[model samples]
Target chain A: MARIKFSTLTEQMFYTLLCLKEECCGMDILDKIPEMTDNRVNIGSGTLYTLLEQFCECDMIRETKTEGRRRSYILTKTGREILEKEYMRICAQAEDYRRFFSGDK
Target chain B: MKDTKRRIELYSFFDHSGIEKHLEKMAKKGWILQKITNLFWVYRRANPQNLKFSVSYCPSASEFDPSDSETKNEYNEFCRHTGWNYAASGAQMFIFYTELENPTPIQTEPSLEVEAIHRSVKKTIIPIYFILMLLAVLQGAMFVTNLISDPIDILSNSTSLFTGFGWTMLFILFAAELSGYYLWRHKAKKAAQQGEFQESHGHKTLYCVTLLAVFIGFIYWIISLIINSSYFELTIAVIMLFAVAALIFLVNGVKQFLKNKNTPAKVNMTLTVVSSFVLSFLLIGVVTFGIITAAKNGIFDRESQFYQSLYLDSPPLTVEDLLGNEELSDRYITQISGGKAVLLGKYEIRQYARSGDSDAKLPGLEYTVTVVKARFMYNFCKNHLIKNKDKTEGGKVIFADHYEKTDAAEWGANEAYRRYRSANYVNQYILCYYNYIVEINFDWEPTASQKSIVGDIFS
Candidate 1:
């Protein structure tokens, strides 16, 4: 069975959405992810470009401004809800891991 | 020294791994990627360096997009920020190279990469391939129908055989490419789900072999046409080839001219397609007019007269021979035409009085000799020949024409059949020998002695 797109956010997708929380240039997200993760999580430009387009198509992101070839985008309200759900899912996974390892029910 | 080179590469549209490795190898050999088009890839001479290459697909991009389009520029800027320099792009595919030893790959997420490639393929190669495969299937069905209904004509005609072989090869190539891509995509998607990138390979060798075979077949077909066709036929063939070549060159020229002018993709595409159809019809009209004018001027007639006189091989059995009148030898013209292929050879001889002859109703003789080169084809040749004249309507037999068994001893053959049209016996007889099938038609009822003469000559 095929999974619904973006139902479960990938690591790159999570960071990309996190970067879009504050209005930023589309190209800046490529740099912001590495800086936010301390060089741990990096997204390819091609992958980022495609993701941005897809995000815009699904209304998860919308164009805010365009200067020359550089464009800015911000996460929509729908995008924030999905991002919050993903954050909760990750938190639940972490909670489960701690409970199992720390011998706490 | 030539600073640039061009090569015809057959890499699949979705075979990014293959294209990346190939570009890397070329870079190490002192050739830097320059440009790519549907026809060929161009490379420029450069210092030998170990370069890392990546291929990424932009489904929104088109081949006719302006070189400096904002979307492409923004995409390029994004790549440049990561130390990847744009090399060249064709259609929806972009190639980027980096001097940095371990620059982040252009496509990091495997699922997204696969999706991008699939989207790009859908935009370009898939539809074209699907249309071509449909054409191949249609041609293949027609060829098989002809083979079953009129085996002798198809087996004996070089053009038919060549076209059949070409279409079959094309179908095989398309099927292999389509199936290979789908299978790879399936595996790639599975790997992508597990966060692994699956490398893709193209059937480059299959492409090369199929193209070579088709080229050789085309050359053989041309040679056969020259040898077997009349002067008028040969001229028309040459004209047709030139017209097709000119149409392709002109259409491509128009597209390139439009591209150079930075025409928008939709306008460019529409104009290109419209021009192709317009140019094709124009060429056809020109060829048809030229042929009619030449015919009116008697150019083909004079040439055919000269050609006919030069290469008239003597027929084994002639009207004079059947009539036993040596004096009639000078009255009739004997024309022979045939073609030979690997499976069989077929030749037809027609002897009739010349057009200007005083005797308009001189008895004529016509016969076709089929030499089955392979034993397996003997039965097929014989069966089709026997049922060649059967009439049908809408795939159903309306009037059944058959052959009645005749005595083989008199004709000195293993088997013989006299043709019957709706129970009326005709003067045509089909004789089957060890490796030969002969169909002879007599203008007048042939005597027993003439039948023996045909059997003696053909058997």
Candidate 2:
């Protein structure tokens, strides 16, 4: 439930959402992020809590249900849209670098 | 090659001028001073790979060193000679060690005997303070005479209080440093007890801080005494010195405390240092307070005329002529003790009668004598302070000086003294009596003098 748009995000939070492409809990999100990123991006308990709290408040993510005591979260349409925008930004920058390397720039 | 690092312990003789000299000396060794903390100088070598070194002064170490037995004995003798500012090292809280290479925070309760030895150790500055105190007493007229005396007189007068004040400061600075040390050590000790002494490899900073504190204290006192000033001035001077001093301790202590929290052993050491640091400051403050009080009250010189005037072997008392006004009355009773005499003072005997006398005479004077009573008996019915704050000044004067206009003239018949408030008749007579252990203990002395004093009033 991500609500407000942020100008920039920290490395841990950015990588956390990338891991949370599906419904996942805080620990699972932390576990998945570094595992997916080949252990490059590590999120501690505090960082995960802060980021999840912000995303939930912003309405960009929604909690589906609570299994035992842990809550699970999935991105809303807005959250996916924001994630897609970030993806495109990196893709476009990557393309520019490709052009420079291939002498197309 | 790494720059030849130079780290020196600033002893009690260290001063700002001395520190400047130290810095100057360091500069010559290609080490440039970086920052200053209370009494520490952090420096870095100008050479490549930047080898860093820190220096601080602590005057107590020489006393703390067990190697110097003669010095230790002299220090003990000095403690006997001085009052409060004696060797504080004996307080069982502070200990000293030196010539440490890569010294780390030590974890253990400082030994009681080691602390005692340290306390008995003489500070380098105390003998000088004693001499200066002597000079101040001889130049008593200089309280206001500095303007006429040579420029150096002001310098001479100011130094004693300052030196005394500086020695006083060691209590604070040393305590602060020791507190940090103790906290670190205690934390270390606790962790070590739990089999976890995660070595805090290069914590020579704590040592530097301790040394700096002692050094600053020594120098401050040295400087304070060298300049012309009063105790009041020196108080502000000491406060300012400590204020600047605290900034360094707080910053360094906080950083170290937070960083050490990550490691259980380091955390234990940190805990020890923090608690010890607090107690050290408290001890320092209390010791300094005593020093300040001494400075204020001053040490008496037996040869002075002032002492001669104040000298008295007996309880000398003066009875002033009674001055009674329409609304006020007073009798001054001064006392000079004869061989440490204790005056039970006087109690009101407004009413007197024969051995078994029971007469309801006029209420002008009506009272009873009761012995074996405490100083003040609280009256539940009267919600008021019946006595004055100062018991020595005696009880308050009622119906005198400023008699309330609404004061009643007399008491009604069959009336209890408690019935009236401010203006009761029988006018709350301030019962005055002196418990004199005479030649005989008469349960009831039917003396004429006693009767006359009470009159034929309420018996």
Candidate 3:
């Protein structure tokens, strides 16, 4: 069975939405992810291009400005909501791991 | 030494890993990828370097899209920032290369890559293959039907046999390609779920072998035609071949010209398709008109003095042998035609009175001799000839016209059948000998002596 689109955010998708919160140009997100993660994670250029297009189509991102071939985008309300849900899901998993390791019910 | 080279590469649309590895090898040999067309992949001379290559798909991109379209430009800008330089693109496929040792790859997500490849293949190769497979199936079905209904006609002609073989080979090739791609996709999707990119290696050997076989078959067909056909037939065949080549060249030229002028993708495609249909019809019309004109000019006339003299030179059996009239033999015209295929060979000889001659009412003799080459086909050929001796029309059998078994010893050592219509005897007989089935018809009934002569000459 195929995964439903945007049902759960992959690492690259999560960071991409996080970078677009500031209305940054599309190419800047490629570098911003690594900088924000202390060089721990990086998104490929082709991957970012395709993700941005798909995001725009699903109304998760909207174009903010255009300068020739360089375009800036900002996260939509739906995008922010999805990102927050994913963040909470990760925190819940961490809490469960901590509880099990500490021998707590 | 030439600085540019072109080769026909038979890479599947989704075989990105294979293509990338091939390009890397080419780069090491100092040939850099430049451009790709439907027929050829072109490369330019460059200094040898250990470069890394990536193949990515843009599902929405059209081959007719302008080179500097905004979407393509923006995509290129994104790649340039990551140190990946554009190499070449054809249809929905894009290739990039980088000199950096650890440059970021163009595609990193396995699932996304698979989705993009599927989209691109659906938009291009899938439909084309489906259409070709349908045509092949239809042709193969027709060939089978002909083989069942008229086995002797197909078995005796090299052209028909080759056509059937060619279509069968094409169907196998296309079916294998389609099934192979789908099976790969199935496995690749499972691998992608495990965060891996499955490698794709198509049946390149099958493609090469099928193409070579078809080419050899085509050459054999042409040679057979040349050996068996007259000059007029050979000329017509040459013209048809040239016409087909011209049609392809002219259509592609038009499409390229429009693309160069920055025509919109939809308009360019529409115009190209419309022009192809028009040009095809025009070429067919021209060929038909030329044939009609040639016929009007008596180019196909076989009754000329030259042809008459050639036909008069040799005839296996004549009416003179049966009627014992040497003077009447000079007024008769003879025609001989035959062809051979793998299964069998057939030749027909006809001797009749010349047109406009006072002896137009003279008797004529015609006979066809089928020589079965393969022992396995001998019984099949013999049975078909016997069964087909009866006449049928509009899905109903004509009971009045049929063959009745006769004594074999009269004709020679084998079986024989004489024809009858409405309780009246017809001067026709089907004689079966070892490896030969002869059907002979006479304007008048053949005497026992005449049958003996035919059995001796044709057995």
Judging by DockQ against the true structure, name the best candidate. Answer: 1
**Which regions of candidate 3 deviate over 4 angstroms?**
A1-4, A64-66, A102-105, B302-315, B318-338, B348-360, B388-415, B420-425, B433-436
Native-referenced DockQ of model 3: 0.73
- Report the lDDT tens digits of candidate 2 across residue range B261-363: 4433335445556755675677568657865676567543222212221223211211110111212112211222111101111112222222333433311
Q: What is the TM-score of chain A alone in each candidate?
A: 0.93, 0.85, 0.91
The clash count of every prediction, one per candidate, is: 0, 47, 0
Winner by DockQ between candidate 3 and candidate 1? 1
Model 1, docking class: medium
Each prediction's whole-model lDDT (CA) = 0.87, 0.39, 0.83
Cα lDDT for residue B393, model 3? 79
Estimate candidate 2's alpha-carbon lDDT, on a 0 to 1 scale.
0.39
List where candidate 1 sits over 4 angstroms from the true fold: A1-4, A102-105, B302-316, B324-338, B349-361, B373-376, B387-416, B420-425, B432-436, B452-459
Model 1: how far residue B284 lies from native, Å: 1.3
- Cα lDDT of model 1 by residue, B1-459, tens digit: 999999998887678889999999999999988998768799999999999999999988887776566667888899999999999988788899999988988889999999999998998789999999999999999999998777888887778899999999999999999999999999999999999999998898999999999999999989877876667778888999999989988998888888888888889889999999999999999999999998888887653322331123456788888888999988877777766766777878888888899988898889888989899999888887776567889998777678889998788889999988875788989999888898999988888898898778777
* lDDT by residue (tens digit), candidate 1, A11-98: 9999999999999986789889999999999999999999999988888889999999899999998889889989999999999999
For model 2 chain B, the run of ten residues with the poorest summed lDDT: B315-324
TM-score of chain B of each: 0.88, 0.20, 0.88
Interface RMSD, one decimal, each candidate = 0.7, 26.3, 0.8
